[model samples]
Target: MLVLFLLGTSSSALAKGQKHTYWHLTSDAGEEAGKEFESQLRSVLVQAEGTHHTTEGSLAELLDQKPLKVPSCFEGAKLCTTVPELLVEALGVDGLVEGRISAAADGYQVELTLYREFGGTPKVVTRSGADLEGVVRDAVGALFTLEAAIKIYTEPAGASVFVNGNLVGESPTRVQVHEGNHGLRLEKEGYEVLREDLTVLPGEVREYNATLVPKVTQITVITWAESAAVYVDGKLSGASGAPIDVMPGAHSLELRANGYRPIEITFDIAAAQRRTIQLAMLKEVEDPWARREQAIRTYRLYVEAGYALTLQSIGFAGATADIAGSTYSPTSFGGEDRASLVFNGVKLAVGYTMERLGLVFLGVDLMVASMDSELILTAQDTARRESAVGQGASHIALYPLQGTFRELWGAFGAEAQTGLGVSFDSLNGDLTGDAFDLSQTAVFWSLAASGRYYLSEEWSLTLGYRMDYDFADQRGLRHGFFAGVGFNLPLLVDAGGESKDESLPEQLEEDVPVEGTDVPESTLQKLEQSGTEGGREP
Candidate 1:
């Protein structure tokens, strides 16, 4: 903190022999926080009427970039640098000031010090709040955050509260406590419940914002009067006197009243989601009706099934891993070396998309390949074994291993997709034909840009460009254009049933002429059925 002020030795104070002043100050720049010493002194001497005893000092980091407000995202730790003692001596003043910061509740504070000229005891200054600007008006934790403290609040207020697994407070005079993250819960009898993660910084006041998510329930033993106890994820959310508001996502809810058959349902909650569930109290069925209803639910799900579609692509490639050994064969692959090895195509796909959070999606990939190659191996002292096998002859071995690293290996991020969703993509792949199939395949990877325009719900137009190493027949960059029809596979989604989208062929039925005339039906059949034959409209 840097303040420009002017002060003079008070004659009345001097006469009374009480002239030691307690002063506080503030600075606008983070790097020059210590610059306050000289700045304040200069302001007092040049800007104010000061004459008796004067002191000036600086803070720790004189040239560090200010810490960004984005918390841990953009830190200012790098901007901090130390100044030499000579420079501090050059601006000889009464004292130097220094301090460090730690979070409290809603804000942060710093413990400052006033250094003496003779290296005497330092003056300790403590600011206690988020609003503390300086010691002049003044009066002041390295905390690594962990579990965050979530705030809990009622729309109106005065709701009973609970924290971590226990009952804590009631609304209105709700106690705001702790500086850090924590599990929180808030509830009210007969109201929806709230529970969430909370992260509060030291010296910061946090809110555990809980709102009731309404749900249409089937807890009624009887139509309009029965009240079921609402449990969120197997725990009591408020006493379910009415539909309670709960945050959306996956949750297990049980509605049990004494006389009513206990009913439990699981569902996913979304943001700002409002659900009105009417508990349809059902009468105790004999046997057949209950079985019939269960059967209907299962049958209906089968009828509403959607279609399946697959995206396809084809490619030819080759490559060579050149060994730097003295006695090794330098082989090449691609269009130059014509052989039985051909890469029909490679495909990656995801299927069975539902309205869920990618729960139903299953990713798959296929590679169509046939290749033959001979490798020079040092088996005998003077003679090398040339192992040549037929194309598509090698058996593929499957080894699936999952490994976790302390650091992240891959990530998807883009500045353009910060808020809105439109973005760009790139990908590459490389393969070695045999040992050295350079003439056929060289590029191990390729990059492609694709733009899609959906003209209608049933169809879309796609355009793409790829800049890649020539692996097919060792060709440089072979550009290609493609246009294809996109249709839903309604048959695939059905349980091996006839596709509704495909109608019966009309050409299957044929007309025959009678022997005596050109009529389509016989005289006997004409009496039994309609005699005239149908003709195409011209």
Candidate 2:
């Protein structure tokens, strides 16, 4: 026998102990056959357990001899739709069970229908078998099978519900589960999974409500620098070295700190996950004063060695020159007896430039020179005598306004200097055979104009002319021209640290450290000072 049960309504009505009246079981085989099947089925129902069975005879008696009319639809049809309504109105039964039997090729096919008093669509159980009584027995047993009704609700209404590891449906839904122990699981995205063990009894309508917790991901950022701002998805979250909470997914993170390179990253996180990101930020150079201090060469040490040519003259006031024991009054004594001297000397200077004020330098200068000259004395008798003289001077030169010209061809400058010096003059080898020597030390003041050309940051070439007038003992005038190669040693001021080539704005914008890193303390202090000073200025 092949018996199949199809339930059209919830099986809760079929639970044990329900009251139902047994209606007629019709058949097309014959009236005698129908009567025999109905009698056997009624006998079986009366013996059944867990239910109250009322027969058609008892229902008619309850109505006081009223004639019972079976609906015409049950005569040969597969279903009887009007039976539950009639039974409920006449006998006031809770439910009604009706069936129809038809001849099949094998033997017989039976369709059993159950309807509740509320007039819903009926439940049908079908069976086909050669043994008519056995089919009726099996159909009755199938009709009243036990099941538990489960109503599942979740905080998020659309979570998938699984019963005994099988997907049932989404909650807030109702499902008919077979009576027993079962594992129930609910799952939703971004929420924790919920699982519980359930033991349901027959006819139990169990309501389950689950409040699911959300899945959170924690991100810890460990930066090499302090006070780094941490940003997630373009919104500022907090400082680095702190934990940030976020939903699990792809995100953009940015780390920014003063004086350090900014860093950006894109990453994905998993649910209930902990992630740590360790970052080292690069340094940035953003202080303009520091850069200017480095770029400005503040100290200059100069050593110059040069060759000089000088003209020395002594004026005569009513003076007479003795030539070969003869006395003569000479009119142009200063012009005719002028001595030209060549000297080799060196000049050394130490200077400090006020770069912030505008490339002006204040310095002390020293010049030392040794000069030897041949003085020629001539007479009207066509006699010429020569005397050799030696001269030396040590002078200190000072410039009131000395500065570099930046816009000219490659580093050039001009300065005017006035200085005082002691000049030593010696005359030896007189025109006569007798040797004579005369020495004089005199104080002299000099005026000079010099031009300098820089060969590099620390080297130069200088050329100048100077005039000197002696003021004590021997009143004499000297004019000199000099040419020299200069070596300039620069003493650069410390701008807190080594200078960088990046511009200040660029460094401030992009070059900074991310995490646990640090800029030099000296550099940072200088930068802050520079900023403070700049703010104070116009």
Candidate 3:
């Protein structure tokens, strides 16, 4: 008896498109086993119908040969058992089976060899038995099986597939293969390539379903403003018009345009995602000069006209003559024992200031007011009143401290000013029915402050309070509030629009030698380009 054991059976032995035609040949020996064993072995080989069976007789006829030497399929090699190439070509078969039965002490010894002509070693079995057919049946059963069909599919169809680096077909395809590990690869444009190792068993129908992730994501850049440049991670990509393909992750994006503030944002994009983002651009706030420089640069010229109220008083003392033996006190000169009156006035001022010089200003204030005061005299026991009326003009030198806050297109500011100047005035007075000159001229000073709200680029409304004091003896303080309108004189001084200062640093002539030192051409060019001219000439 012959025992046959298979280490394993590979269904891929019948891999799709693999050659399967096999020819079987046999020779018998032993007295009683001769014809019966040959017949039994042929029946057993036929049981492997999954492989296309070709009889020895048919193969010999196809090659036009008679009494074909079955051992020639092994190329006359002993113990080496691959089918000869020429024999396979002549018969057009993938493999062949050769069997022999010889006399043994137990009645018969049988040997069978299975040869795959394409490549690889052969399978062989030998047995000593009186029952040769049983051995052949077991051998065939252990060596062959139905191939497994592998079905491959992808989420997006039409991906090319490869098995062991050999192109198989597009996905949604089925391939019959022997049961074993097979290297699989799926490839598609714009999607991540896939690779895997697969194993299948005999008669099994295996299925592979895969969803491939995209390699890039779709990113659309949108902005409310036009002509904005788009950047990805600080690199300029293009203008904000179309969608951009980017790798999936957090990416820094920037949008910028002229006259608009730039914006930066970060985004996380997933694979195969379509996302739209809106970027807002805002107009930049323009300041031509620095805050401290603005007042000196533009706000120094103005014309002011407003109303003012003044409080006036005079002190005089006199004694009544002894015509009737009556006396009068100085405080009693005015009928009410006081000489004080409130007067209303109009004031106009025109001035220019140099803020760089600590906001110093030169201006003339013209002021006119009706001044009135009374004096009472008691002479011969009679009481009387005296009054005066006058007006004045003042020339002032002002130094103010200023501050500003910006609004839409303009600004609001306030200034506190202290000024010293000269005041000249004329008054006529009647003292107890006698006319006399009540005129005076003297230096005066004022403490003033104003709040200004600019309505436009060059015009403003001003509310101011001022207290004025004259140095003349017996003169009282004139203090009041004023409201005015002011204008900026652009022709007098150019308050330039928003611009960047490009002037460069300069070295003082005092720091340089009287005879100029040698300077490199590059340094000179830089100085000239930077608009800095300094130092003594050679």
Candidate 4:
């Protein structure tokens, strides 16, 4: 016979003990083993489906627009008296057909319905009674509902990224979530914040590699840039410092500068990590400031080799003129070193820099020639001797601006040095007799002003004009330009956490380290004396 013991459903996912909305059990067997079966079956079904008891009196009030928030099901919540009517509604039909078969037999069936007070119908599906325990066990495993792993990617490589208040990667648009429910968020500077709920599963790797349209959010950071645009996960985010929200995760960041070229980069993201976007632009001749700052320990030490166009010209009278009606034309010539190169063979520089009180550097530059040119002059008494003219070559030293120098938008350096040079020809036509040694160990003084722009951190070029007077009394001009390739051997000085004050009674004031005054006691005292000599210094 088709036995129908009891059938019911509720408006709430939870209820309190006997007060829970449900169909009371009754059958031809009266209230014997039938009651026991009903109790056992309800216990299993409610627990598995995450519907238990509610302490509230009104079921309708308890199951309003939302389910009651409960402890993590991972703790094995006991849901004996109530089951959500929503699950019952999911059957598509009207009610739920359920029953309990003796475990010693096969499976059981349970009948469940919704709004049965108005005679709602129920549907039936059959399964083993033992399977109920497994369903409950699996449902109570993980936390944060079911989530699937999210898989993300970007185009043109590196894109700044974040996910769910956590930083997973600098360029990874991908992530993971479980089945059930989740909150997903994505961000990159210059782009708008993107977010949505994510229903995930174990095998799913959700993709977030869509091009981010740029946005002009609540930030305005304009420094220097070129073809320079921003992107996050294949999307155009905005220009540098364009505010945008990001999920917590790993992501990539790229900064493009003007030129026939662009720049790209990658980095990590984590809670508490700085999320500011900025780009400092410069000529496309050397390293980008962003990259150079990473390896350069000392600014002056970074210049390894350079090329330039320099013009050194001097016009003189008083010497090549006769008291005649016309000026003498004794080899009249004036030209500039249109191009030249210099390589720093021996360079030394060092400094200590902190974010606070500015920066100070001390260094000297020693450069020998890679290529250079010069002019010379001489005189011969009344005789047609052509005098002795010297050529400047090799064995030279130059000192670039160091210590406290001038302040100009351009590069300026003072030059004064000693070197050995040699010249040929113009020794009064005396092909012999020291004529070849005319350009010998001479003193040369030069004052120069130059301009430079960098395309990247690795390469740069300069334009300079120098006026040099050699000891030969014959002064001529030479000018040229050169390209610079830089190499940096960095000495990293990571400030350790300020040493804590461990030596005192809490009432005593702690001694703070003085700025620019890191030295041994003796050295400090010596510096103090020097300061005393100069009134004071910070």
TM-score of 2: 0.32
Write model 4 residue lDDT over 1-538, tens digit each, in one string. Answer: 1222222344433333422222323333344444655555443333323233322222223323444444332122222224433433422223322233333243333333233223334333333344543322232222112234566665434555555566666555555544456665566664556665666543334565656544532323233332357665556767654565554456665555443124344444553333554433322332223333332222333434543333332222223432122222133222432213232233332333222211224333333333223322333343332322223223233333322222222222221222222221111112223323222233454444444444443343444443444444344433343334444333443343222223212231222222221323543343343232221333
Given candidate 4, what's the lDDT at residue 119? 38
Number of the top TM-score candidate? 3
lDDT of 1 by residue, 63-141 (tens): 1222323223113212112422222243233333444444556454556555545455556756545454422223222
- What's the distance in Å from true for residue 40, model 2? 55
Each candidate structure's TM-score, on Cα atoms with residue i matched to residue i, is 0.20, 0.32, 0.40, 0.22
Q: Candidate 4: TM-score?
A: 0.22
Candidate 2's residue-wise lDDT over 153-253, tens digit each? Answer: 99869999999999989999987777789899999877889999999765456898999887877888775466689999999988877889977889998
Q: How many clashes in each structure?
A: 62, 13, 11, 90
Top-lDDT structure, candidate number: 2
lDDT of 2 at 417: 61
**Which is superior by TM-score, 3 or 4?**
3
Write the number of the candidate with greater TM-score, choosing between 2 and 4.
Answer: 2
On a 0 to 100 scale, what is the lDDT of residue 367 in model 2?
Answer: 44
- Prediction RMSDs, each to the true structure: 35.5, 19.4, 18.5, 25.5
Alpha-carbon local distance difference test for all models = 0.34, 0.58, 0.55, 0.36
Residue 518, candidate 4: C-alpha displacement in angstroms: 52
